[model samples]
Target: ESLNKLMKNLYSTHPHFVRCIIPNEFKQPGEVDAHLVLHQLQCNGVLEGIRICRKGFPNRLVHSEFKQ
Candidate 1:
């Protein structure tokens, strides 16, 4: 019953996902590896997705809509 309800709710709305990628395996603060981050982004298709979104709708918001 709970699963059915959850599925129904999810289907009713448009959902956007946020992917969090770790910068380093060491988990140290103030440490970031550019190559690792780039590799993760490529593997996750995030870069390509952003490129497609930009190509489709570069300016989605109007000035008035943005203000609110």
Candidate 2:
């Protein structure tokens, strides 16, 4: 019960800390759905097992990769 309440609170508070609201027109629903699926796959380590790999990095962290 306590864990459930904490999760509920986290979800409720998340939008307040969100930095930007991207326009839906600029982001296709299919593409966004695919990204969410990819992130889940990455978290589960499924991506590592695939023959073809895509380098995954958050937008801010991407700049650091280029600097090296």
Candidate 3:
């Protein structure tokens, strides 16, 4: 109850939403699915949010190590 109240207060004062998308479900190393990524982005409205915000940049990285 206290945690929920804290979260509500935080959002009321400064709203923020985070959505994460995994590339694939096989847990393979060094694998990326462009279609899945794009679909997730679309579904999450990230691309639309970017256009709406128009002040931040999208970030991605290629990790050197991803042990699976």
- The residue-by-residue lDDT of candidate 2 on 1-68, one tens digit each, is 99999979976762312123332435765445556566666766665645344454312336766555
Clashes of each: 0, 0, 0
- Number of the top-ranking candidate, with TM-score as the measure: 1
- Report residue 66 deviation for candidate 2 (angstroms): 43
Each model's lDDT comes to: 0.82, 0.53, 0.75
Give a tens-digit lDDT track for model 3, residues 1-68.
Answer: 99999978875773447799888767577898888889999999988987866766533334653221
Better of 1 and 2 by TM-score: 1
Model 1's C-alpha root-mean-square deviation from the true structure amounts to 7.3
Model 1 per-residue lDDT tens digits across residues 1-68: 99999979977975556789888889788899889999999999999987988888443557896666
lDDT of 2 at 6: 91
